[model samples]
Target: MKANGPFKILALLFVTVLAFYLIAYHTIEGRRNRNGPWIVAFTNDLSGAPALRIDHPALAITNVQLVFPDAMLPTNFTAKTILFQRPRPVPFPLPMGECIFMDTTFLPGSVVMRMSGHEVQLIPRVLTINGREQPWKSGETIALTAILTNAISPRLNGR
Candidate 1:
C-alpha cells in the first residue's frame, strides 16, 4: 500500500487540473456566445436628419453613447469648451440625435467619417432596414453622408 500512496496523490492532482481547464473553457465559450456580434450607428444632430435606429437580434446589452467631432479633436477643447463629455468607447445603442461616431474595429477595417472626424468601424453580422435584412460583408463601410445627400438632394431640388 506504500507504493500506491504517491500514485493516488498524483492522479488526484491531474484530475483537479483537468477539471479546472474544462470549466474555464466552458465559461469562456458561454460568454462569447452570449455577447453576440457588435453593431454601431453613427448619427449627426446638426444635420437635421432622422437618426438611424440600429438593432440586432442577439444584442442583449446596450453599450455606450459617444458624441462626435468633439471626441475627435486633439486639443484640450473639452477643458475649454462647456460641454458634458461622456467616456469615449465603442458605442452599441443608437442614442437619438446625439451619436456621431461609433466604432468596433481597431485596425485594417477602419472607416473615417467626414462629419464626425472619427473612424466608424463595425463588425456587422447582419444589418437590416424596415425589418428587411440587408447584405453587409466583412470589412465593408457605409458612408452616411453620401446616403443622406443622395436621398435628400433630389427632394430639395424638386426632382
Candidate 2:
C-alpha cells in the first residue's frame, strides 16, 4: 500500500505537468496558425544593405528595414528565405510597435539560401552562411515571405 501511494503521487505529478505543457503548446500553435504560413525573404537593397520583404496571400508588405543591434549584419550579400510557422515570442503583454500587418506573430525558421556557390541553412538558433555555422543572435530582427500559389516558389523576384 505504501509503495502504491508513492507511485500514484509520481504519476499524478507527471500527468499534471504534461497537461500543462500540452495546453501551453496548443495555445501557442493556435495563435501561430491563425494567420496561416508566411514566406519571408532577406536580400540586399539598392544601397547593398540588408532589407526585409514579406509576402502573404492576403497582404503586400515590402522594403521593411531590418534593424540589428550594434550594427550587426549578415556577412553574405545574397538572399535568404524561410517559412514562418510559429509566432514570435513577445516579452510584453501587448506589442509595442504599430500594427502594420494583421499578423505579426511569425518568426523565420528553417531557412536555406545560396551564396557564392555555397549552401546556407538558417535554422532556429543556428545560422549557416557560406557553409560555416554560427549562433543566430537574438537581437537580430527577422522577416518573412508568403506562399500564395502551389506552382510558384516562395522567393523574391523569382530568385
- Number of the top-ranking candidate, with lDDT as the measure: 2
Q: Deviation in angstroms for 31 in model 2?
A: 1.4
lDDT of 2: 0.46
TM-scores, all candidates, are 0.32, 0.32
> What tens-digit string does per-residue lDDT give for candidate 2 at 1-159?
898999999999999999999999999977656644545565555555445444444233332234222222345445766445644443211111111122234443343443222334534445554466765443454432322345655694477
Clashing pairs in 2: 39-144, 39-145, 39-146, 40-144, 40-145
TM-score of 2: 0.32
* Model 2 error, position 143 (Å): 21
List runs of model 2 lying over 4 Å from the truth.
40-54, 58-159
Return the top candidate by TM-score: 1
Candidate 1 clashing pairs? none
